[model samples]
Target chain A: MAADNDTISGYTAAFEGFEASLNGGARSPLHARRREAIAHLQEHGLPTARFEAWRHTNPAPLANGCFPPVVTAGKLSAEAIQPFVVSGIDGPLLVFADGQFVPGLSRVGDLPDGVQVHSLSAADSETAAIITANLAALALGAEHGFAALNTAFVRDGAVVTIHAGCTMDVPVQILHVSTGQAGLTTPRTLVVAAAGSRASVVETFASTTAGAGVLTSSVAEIVVGAGAVVEHARIHLHGADSLHAGTMHVTEEQDARFTAHTFCLAGRILREDVHTVLRGEHIESTLNGLSLPLGDDHVDNYTTIEHVAPDCSSHELYKGVVGGRAHNVFRGKIHVHQAAQRTDAYQSNQNLLMSDDAEINSKPQLEIYADDVKCSHGSTTGQLDPDALFYLQARGVGLQQARGVLTRAFAGELVDRLQHEGLRTHVERLVSARLDAVLADQGGAR
Target chain B: MLKITNLHATVDGTEILKGINLEVAPGEIHAIMGPNGSGKSTLAQVLAGHDAFTVTEGSVRYENEDLLDMAPEDRARKGVFLAFQYPVEIPGVNSAYFLRTGLNEVRKARGEEEIDAYDFLALIREKMALVEMDESFLKRSVNEGFSGGEKKRHEVLQMAVLEPRLAILDETDSGLDIDALRVVAHGVNQLHTPQNSAIVVTHYQRLLEYIVPDFVHVLMDGRIVRSGGKELALQLEDKGYDWIREETAAAAAATQPAGA
Candidate 1:
């Protein structure tokens, strides 16, 4: 663990300069909020490995670098974004370069009557007020440094508002590509699904070929209204050298259904946080995450589900495939409040350690204040079954390829659960290709 | 098709097979009857190249080629198959996929092009039906969640698909009931031909009734104490293994050299 002071010093200095420049421009209503958020980071600094939650994934590399914000946004054409787009979906596509939106590459066709989509800075005055009121509502500003920093610089991600009784047939895709040199980006997405409405959202984060290692700290806040259904998937496709810390916070109302899927496919250092609050009865909340880390990657996932009302249910399944010297951590907590009677929660964490040196630490905690609640949690960590491997090899599948098939099957369950067709196939191909690369690198096949 | 001479093997520093001799000609069904822990399964495993058993001193020849030199997979590719006493359940590997891969491996070793998915599906459906298995078995994980009988049937299904020249059945009828045993025996019988032979290792004579052996041998203390015609199994089943054990002991005592 690196010293927290040294970790945040570089960013703190750059942030001061950036703050001064923003002050010189026309003062905005968010100036105070941004200042307060940066002040919060200055007080707490970055979380070191000394912090229990940060024990497995050290945030030093992310905070130590002096990654100035994006300046002089690069040109993005349809050709450049074509490779990242999910084909067969004709819904809205929002493209962001380094935290700022690129109008030339974005396409928002005819939307339903009551749906509105806009970049944070470009949102109408009424939507701007809504965004401001909900900004950082899910994440407390003082607990995390990267989150506070993201809050301090939250300006140009996506703001989607679905009016009541509107159910979208197509999913909204948000693509954020970091290009040119190593820098820092803060992508803030706020989705508001009004009462009786439903929508699906997919957020993908990646880096361009010319782009060096970029450190990204992104925050997504989702609001699920009563009788609404919202499905969201966060895909991390950053380069092997990049660092990412993502946080998703959701709040569900009465009879609302919320499902969240997080894929940590690539990155040198990755950490994900998903927290959902169920405040109404008959609410169904599901959280799923699949992480495949190779080489010296460190991946961490932390999830929390708060049941504040009666008759709510939650389910969580998180799995990780760790290769080489990669290390993974999983911490899930299901807290049922006293008034949340008849709450049902199930949590399971499974890990596959492909290499001898790979490590996984999983901790599932449940705290129920109501005696009427039912909850269970279990975790398992081990290598691929030896008998299973021998069975395949005995039947003539090479040791290397056999490992590929079993590995695919281990993670394929999650891939098959993807409700979207194009996204499911895309992820399936990506995971297959990545498994091939990892197996090929093994050489001796153990 | 197969020959074993002066076979001495051990597992984990514990010797099991002291000395054994067996031979089988093409088109012959040889049954090796033995009591529990008589090294019946060890011989089958050693012949299949299982890493757990070490051949301390022995020679196994298949068509005049040393069988010990090949790996388990290489042995399979070279027309050798062993139906395990306990079929291992491999989760995440579909039964059809595993079967096709095995068949393709043998085909590839013979310099044949790999079969496509459609052909594999057709071939597996046909072979599975021969074993009395429904089509749903194709999608299941290899032996996972399958009954004991189903696993044995699955093994025979693989045999029908691979069509190995030397098939070793190691206690294949242990957990199977009468109907499953009959189905499995029938499937094995259907695949048997003049160019292929099977060595059936069993503790019960009931299995021998379905697939009558051309010859039966009683194995004791890891050695074949008596070699005879098919009536040997019936005699052992009727009179129990104690008579054979005492007879072998007396025969050994009479052959012992003076004091030294």
Candidate 2:
């Protein structure tokens, strides 16, 4: 037992050391926050399987390892970032490689009046003040250890603020590319759409190689002020051997509208936790997610929508497909506070298991304290219907092609929900490639 | 083109098809008429290689090939089509895409080059006209939310497109109205060639009148007890299956002594 205790303490100390190296001697108020966060994490320590959010998704792989902090050696070229740009959106671009900001690869053209796009490290005094005021306001008491660790190691993340009543014509794209020598990388982001302001933002995380054993911990904070409409999308396309842990914290004020789409593909083990708080009345939030995990990959999505005020509405839908020995977990909770009368909340999670050995765990929960609220939650997990398969086969389609048709249909439902045509099509192509890989493996097995 | 001898099948330990025999030749349309639970649908499913039915005894031959030994898809590739009584709804697969996949797969299995998209579109358009199906049917998901008539028409469209050597219409006219039945039968008739054949499995003779079968077989207790030239279907329609059941029992008693 003493040996076990010493090994655990040693791992925690190594994690602390890793957090300190992310600062890299950078001097700023954000760095001060990082110092405070590290101390806080040290006191609380990493969460274990006892935590409800971390129960089904074990973090032992992350907690027990030693990883070096990644730093930007140089700016990634434009050509390297062009393929990731969301089509049909012309706005300022910010690029990050290996968790560090690269200004040379970014484009900050003439922006609309009262709109600012700058990194936390390069922000002026007033801008920094604005960021400091709301940087980690919504990330309080993050029970999940990875979120707390990301908060503590916050180095260079985007800080966008749109002034009241300002409307940006184009969305801002923040592309984070991980190019490292097989190790862990933690990326952080903070976005704010002020009162009565409207904007769209797209965040993308991708890897350059098939480096195994890589880890990426990301945190995105979104603040939708009163009467504001903000659309945010996050895409995760890491290497097959990479582990991803991401948290999205959203706070919606009165009469605010917030919409988010999360796409997770090609990760070894991924756990995404999304928490949205309706702070004021008449606020609306929509959350949509799609994930595909193949081979020995494991993907978990945990989301919580809290209704703290009266007359708020929220809708959530998440779908997943798992093949091979892959395992997927979906846990969604919608909580309605006593003061939140007339709250309307809905959530659903659907999963398809392609192989007998593949597994999926889904739990949709609703806790309501208000009497006048409407809330509903549903979840389903099942294998392909043999009758449906035979029906397609009788039409002359081979067994493999029939399976592909059904699997694509399962993915097409979520793809149709994407608002952007180009992104939808692009994601569909990725889904196709993933299915092709599954079929190829099946062929190899035979 | 098709032959079944002493066909015996079971489901869930219960025998459904027992010692059934039938034969179909090229350019001929045969109707198997029977009451509910008379194994009408079982014969179609067994011939199409449905996994639910276990062929405990006997054999099925299509074009002199051992049909029972082939996979369901292989049977389809060998030009055997089963128009489902209850068409399965594939929610995400478009009708056009599903048909094209089926067509190309069959062509490839036959050592033929796959048809290009343009040629496929043209072929589908021509078949869709035979059923009077709307152009939007091609874009909609397969059989999902389709009306009874539309699903039947879609089935006929598949038959016309595949041009199978032997097609089995399994209660294809169950839910269709008069006009839809005419369209379905017209599509089947137009696809009939000297080298192709059909087996219409139906409960009523109304569909047989439209499709015009050359022969009729009365199936009861999983065997063909009576065979005639189209008049058997009309007799079963007019006098009902009770008369045939009585005659079958009497004939069996006469052939096999009670104490043997």
Q: Report candidate 2's fraction of native contacts.
A: 0.83
lDDT of each: 0.84, 0.82
| Strongest candidate by DockQ | 2
Determine which window of 10 residues in candidate 2 chain A has minimal summed lDDT. Answer: A437-446
Q: How would you encode candidate 2's per-residue C-alpha lDDT over A91-204 as one tens digit per residue?
A: 888888877788888877999998989877788787788887877675456375667667665557787889999987577888878774555566777778889999888888
Q: Give candidate 1's error at residue A281 in angstroms.
A: 2.2
Top model number, TM-score: 1
lDDT of 1 by residue, A140-160 (tens): 744477788787776578989
Positional deviation of residue A180's Cα in model 1 after best superposition, in angstroms: 4.4
Every candidate's CA RMSD: 2.9, 3.2
- Which portions of model 1 show Cα errors greater than 4 Å? A1-32, A75-81, A139-141, A210-213, A440-446
